[model samples]
Target: MGERLIVIEHEAEAGLGCFAGRLEAAGVEAEVVRPYKGEPVPGRAPAGLLVLGGAAAAWDDEGYGWLPATRDLIARAVDEGVPTLGICLGAQLMTMACGGTVERGDAGLEIGLGEIEPLPEAAADPLLSALPSGPVRAIQYHYDAMTTLPEGAVRLATGARYANQAYRLGDRAWAVQFHPEATPEIFASWTGGGDLPPERAGELNAQVEAAGDELRRTWGKFAEAFAAQLTRR
Candidate 1:
């Protein structure tokens, strides 16, 4: 009802944070379906789709029973020209669903604030065209990387470690490795489980906090652009 976008949330903590508010403010209602909590994923996205990030590897269908269905939904959305945005693990899933490859990065885990530079191709992109020309920092918290892109995907952005940072499949579907929706608190919660050293975690959290205004300004535009896509559809 009233311009809804189906959001596939992979985990509890990975739920829509800032993007939720941004979408609402842009007049796009987000209907989040949490597969990690046994919520069934729909077979299609009638209006649009937003697949959030998670800790699970993209190929671990056996581990995440709903992943196969989720992949199917992503493929269907892309095939039907639905507006879709996938972040982090969602990006990995989109890559794999569209005949790309996602593997554990040989460069190790890419966590914390990272720089992502928009490519020349992004200048014509609907979602990324408004991004700053130079490198912009975003919250990065993922181990697996998209090693190869889908056959027809347009590479939108790149980073130092991971070459495939952002890409657009078909016309409306997009996938980005960085976390545009992560707030400082949400990122802190992610690092709170002692996965990283205390000092490192604190440092990363501080960096995110310091960059809050910039992150909101940059990524909030990205989210609003996506919301506009949904509303237009």
Candidate 2:
């Protein structure tokens, strides 16, 4: 297998942040394709595939013309047993592609540093098992949630607001509703656009900054585990 991983970057601000460093450190090369910027999304992944989060909703095919193609790419990856990781919007897209559901969260926007409770199934998961035992924390910045997982999808972790925090579809595809790739700086940029009230955004950013070390350790290991998967292929 090639050392390259195909990465779908939905927007400029949402590009791979901390996770890019982790992949590089693990000796994995990432080729970022920005469909929003007019770059064509590849139909196949030579080694692995990573679909990053975005501001657009999973169902915004009309608004974002490239979404249909992206979803098609995800379906092909899972069908072919390619190592695939979907984050936030990417996760929702995976759900829709695999006959599941995603909708605007009834509980409202789940933005900030949140704890994820790994289910019993996670103990045996190849990727989530990399997280340290006990409660795991990661960045959360999404309005939509995966209400239902795809058929045969194994739920790995859950949160108070959203039950489908993480899941594994097929043998090689994994999806997470949270943004493990976001750094405090990248998160601050996301909130800087007035998505949340100024004070609330400040509070969330502070929380993320305070938990920087733990986020790095937890999500960094997760990234490394994914990189290991690419190598094994």
lDDT of all predictions? 0.93, 0.93
Residues 1-233, candidate 2, lDDT per residue (tens digit)? Answer: 23799999999999888888889988889999999989999989868999999999999999999999999999999999999999999999999999999999999989889999999999999999999998799999999989988999999999999899999998899999999999999999999997689999899999999999889889999999999999887
Q: Where's the lowest-lDDT run of ten residues in candidate 2?
A: 1-10
TM-score (C-alpha, index-matched) for candidate 2: 0.98
217 Cα displacement, candidate 2 (Å): 0.9
**Model 2 lDDT, full chain set:** 0.93
Which pairs of residues have clashing backbones in candidate 2? Answer: none
10 residues in a row with least lDDT, candidate 1? 1-10
lDDT score, candidate 1, position 34:
89
Per-residue alpha-carbon lDDT of candidate 1 for residues 1-233, written as tens digits (9 for 90 to 100): 55899999988888898898899999998899988888999998989999999989999988999999999999999999999999999999999999999999989999999999899999999999878778899999999999989999999999998899999998899999999999999999999988999999999999999999999999999999999898887
Q: Which regions of candidate 2 deviate over 4 angstroms?
A: none
Off by over 4 Å in 1: none
Estimate the TM-score for candidate 1.
0.98
> What is residue 113's positional error in candidate 1, in angstroms?
0.6
